[model samples]
Target: MTASDEEMPKLLGDCVHCGFCLPTCPTYVLWGEEMDSPRGRIHLMQQHAEGEPLSLPMVQHFDRCLGCMACVTACPSGVQYDRLIETTRAQVELEHPRTPAERAMREAVFKLFPYPRRLRALRGPLRAYQKSCLDKLIRRTGLLDRLSPTLAAMERLAPPLGRTPRLPERVAARGERRATVGMLTGCVQGEFFPGVNAATARVLAMEGCDVVIPKGQGCCGALSLHSGREEEARAFARRTIVAFEAVDVIVVNSAGCGSAMKEYVRLLADEPTWAGRAEALSVKTRDLAEYVAELGPRAERKPLPVTVAYHDACHLSHAQGIRSQPRALLAGIPELTVREIADPDICCGSAGTYNIFQPEAAAELGDRKAANVRATDAELLVAANPGCSMQIAGALGRQGVDIAVAHTAEVLDASLRGLGRGSLVQRPQ
Candidate 1:
């Protein structure tokens, strides 16, 4: 092994061939394929560490993984599948040569999704397409599916275009300022679901936080890091670290960004120059629910009487161990009944860019998750991550389920302002 990958063997050895992760693994749960399971993937990683060639089939298994870190949560052995998979992916990108078609598709996704400006530029055209009802006509005909499944998944997963409001650089606390914090306006979250970021800022300010939003901040490299583009992820991490270095605490609304940002220490471990900064930033980074739960509620929550199913975003619940905070926050709203989805641990198949990359498997998982949500019979579905919201929304749309999906902050923001349920809950079109 090269010096860069010297840790793989030790990480690989941590797995004891346990079957514990199988039930929680989305791919394994879907297919029951041994290689698709976490233990099975670790077995492949072990073979690779011992000098076996990185074969295409083996790489496919890794790529099929959702990287939800549910396995990390399931493992009693405390195996670091998160680190192992990430390391293997970086190696895959370096050593393996993908077919031209797959490479081009991945290249397009990496190019468009990671750049905030590019995504923002898309808003105008996308809004026009949606407004003109052309998207509806095109989707109705299903031409995109025949053209490209990936593109079709993109179309299916696109959130309804709404008013894109500009967030202020700072939002002062409403009453007594308990703390000053910086917020991460993520690429997808900022461009597609601007409402979540707006609500995040408003909720934080209401909770007695002076929210600071640094200008020109883009992706935190969560997409790159999770997908195994190490250098690209590092560059984004560095930019983010520099952008929010002065803030006492960093708050993230999207679960994927929050989880990835919290792992900056490992992402930058090879670079001595950035190691300390990365660690410091990771230490301070918190999910909105996590931070808010820690800060406790200062603003009085007006009644938002509605039954809602809380879809646990894997990154928030499994990766960040934030299962209760969101539930608590939702529960705090008097008369708001929180119903639980059937398989709380299973992912909704929106692991960063996993839904786009592995559309077929993601679709199956999304379908399964949607069925469970349907069983809840709640008036609305609530999730923290935008990707989950979009994925679930798309699945529900496909299944003709009309339950609306809202972010936790959006719900809390509505309650704090004494707004009606219609203000926050929105059905994806």
Candidate 2:
């Protein structure tokens, strides 16, 4: 069937119009409109499915959505909003073409992120921009005011780039281990926050799992696919499946990548040849925290006298429905007080490219999130997904707060090895 024919009914029929999802929806809360809520979106889809025309206003509401999937978790009717929103986005890209500048920016992301070689090549310029204070100076001077709102938004979300970490060819288990696992070093995370990957490797080794950093595993195609570049994302997905074919289990540290990898069967559904293989590989995929937690007896625990506030990454808590695993793992550590952030399930405005693509709304959400994090009065923030970690870290940094941000695996790893309590903290250079 054609794309349009396939998406209409799926998006229309998924929602039962239960108002249970309203309070959990960020956009719905911000707009206070049913049309902006999950159920409303489903209704819009139904209208379109019934041969009704989509108005420009209707499209605007859909575009404003962060697509965080909180509604999916909150829905009692089991609405498949993930599939609906994605299909809606694909429809938007096809039926409602973007302006030239917007199209150019989307093209740039697909060109740079999915291709490992291109991303590696661009690292030099990105690093230089960060180190020279050009990035900061532009924001400080409000130079972006001259650009379009979209470009300004993109500029604000660009983190201060750091040197990419070169992954070791292989890291063997410290003592006897039963199995080996390969890690998918993500595109942005590998380039900006290599230390997280390093920490993940160390933690896995501590748990008696040999860590393999397979070369040539490119971006997981999440950003591309989410932004409507399906064919390109599918190509990268195929490449990733081939690259890590030999590993016993593929561990992903980023919740976004983990969720995308877990959905590889659907992502590659059109490719009959690789559909089953993708499903098998996706089955073996585990979030780093989930993997570490499963190696339960091997995960050593020690007293950590710090208060840690855990922020749930959207992908982990909502998309993957992995709300309890990370918290349970954190609680396993002795002397570490695990406090929950108010609205822990709320999106931190870092919905992959959402921050860059929709800065005004993203910043508003970020500010609110930063306030919530501060209210916790915790010195350390723990999160599983790299995007959430970076976004929250950047937001905290911008507010001049001194709290340290880290992945859940990083904290667990430190506790397991009985290392310094502050080891998980991301120190400013």
Candidate 3:
């Protein structure tokens, strides 16, 4: 769907400068710059729409934003900062001509991140290095730090790649077939954290849903859409839509991917041919937690007997309005003590490659989030997104705080299968 280009200003006009979004905005909290805040960025958008050219100075503020959507949740006037930011980001990508180096970096990122095969290819080399102690040698000698901050941040953010589980084309429900749903084996989730996908299929099947993992299914355009590659995002969204047309629902384990797919109606609104199809796909998309929670926990949750602090992925909690579902799922586990960390609304600095681009600020936020998680004194930290898991786990590890970070689905899968506590921990670090 094509968004109203002129309505960009109208959306900006809806912001009430009451300072309600200030505290919730990550960049504003970091620099105290008015332009870095939600209203301030809206003002910039207003100016650009009027007649002023988009400048590097103006774009830097937009670039620093984590896009965590905390401001959208905090806004008293109910301003749609989420859509506004996305619109402005699309404008930036369209109007702004980045330098050769910056363009190359963006090209490198989009080229690698959205392709599972490319990521899989890198895993073999990375695994060998890690096993050969080259990773330790580089880190101990500070050789990794010698690389560009961005590359170093990417290095640190790398989750230990486990053996990728071969996903089945379909898994029939056990006993009774309640529903047949398509599962999105997303780029990073499929390649880097296949265990989560495997566990999700098991839990869903055990809960009486036949799960379908369509082969040749690619990225759902979450990462691309978030980064303002609008055309690239649309291409991927189209492919995803076609692949899962037969399913009753599309279950997404990743928070960002689900949120992006949910917005496909708006994303494709401009394409008359695909708009209706996109809308149909949007209505059927569900986060893994949302689907499982509403399904009423088909498999009995066994006693966990461990303390777990649940970290809210901004996209899940703030963007998708899925705050209670994941927590409720966790609470349903017998003998599981659920603990809430301080400043639960804050981003863990893992806003969909935000850490890769703005590593310094991302690191600071990650450290802050790690500290809060540490204060919870929980035995395991549960996060809903892969990026959050990697960012928080890396941050905690840097501080010498060793704790397990598990996906919510992984934890639930363990409980359903009656696995012990050790079987459930899937730390990104």
* Model 2 residue 144 CA deviation in Å: 1.2
Cα lDDT tens digits, model 3, 1-429, are: 224666765677788799999998887888799998998998998888788999999899899888899999999888888887777788899899888878887899999999999998999998887778777677777776676778888888887766778888999899888889999999888887888899899989999999999996899999888887889999999999999998889999999999999999999988899999999999999999999888876777888888999999999999899989988899988989899999888899999989988899999999999999999999899988999999999999899998998899889888888887877554344
Candidate 2 residue pairs in clash (backbone atoms < 3 Å): none
TM-score list, all predictions: 0.97, 0.93, 0.97
lDDT of each: 0.90, 0.79, 0.88
In model 2, state the lDDT of residue 128. 81
Tens-digit lDDT string for candidate 1 (207-303) = 9999999996888998898888988998999999999999989999999999899988878877899999999999999999999999998899999
Supply the TM-score for candidate 1: 0.97
lDDT of 2 by residue, 1-429 (tens): 014476657546767776898888887777689898888887887777677766777777777788898988888777778877787777777787567887797777667655667767877887787788788788787768676665666555555666566778688887889679999988877876677888889888878888998887888888867766677678878899998899879999998899988888888877889999889888999998788767774756888777899898998888888888888888878888888899876789888888767777777788778889999998798887766776777678779888888777778778877876767554552
Q: In model 1, which runs have C-alpha deviations exceeding 4 angstroms?
A: 1-4, 426-429
Question: In each prediction, how many residue pairs overlap at the backbone (N, C-alpha, C within less than 3 A)?
Answer: 0, 0, 5
| RMSD, every candidate, angstroms | 1.6, 2.3, 1.4
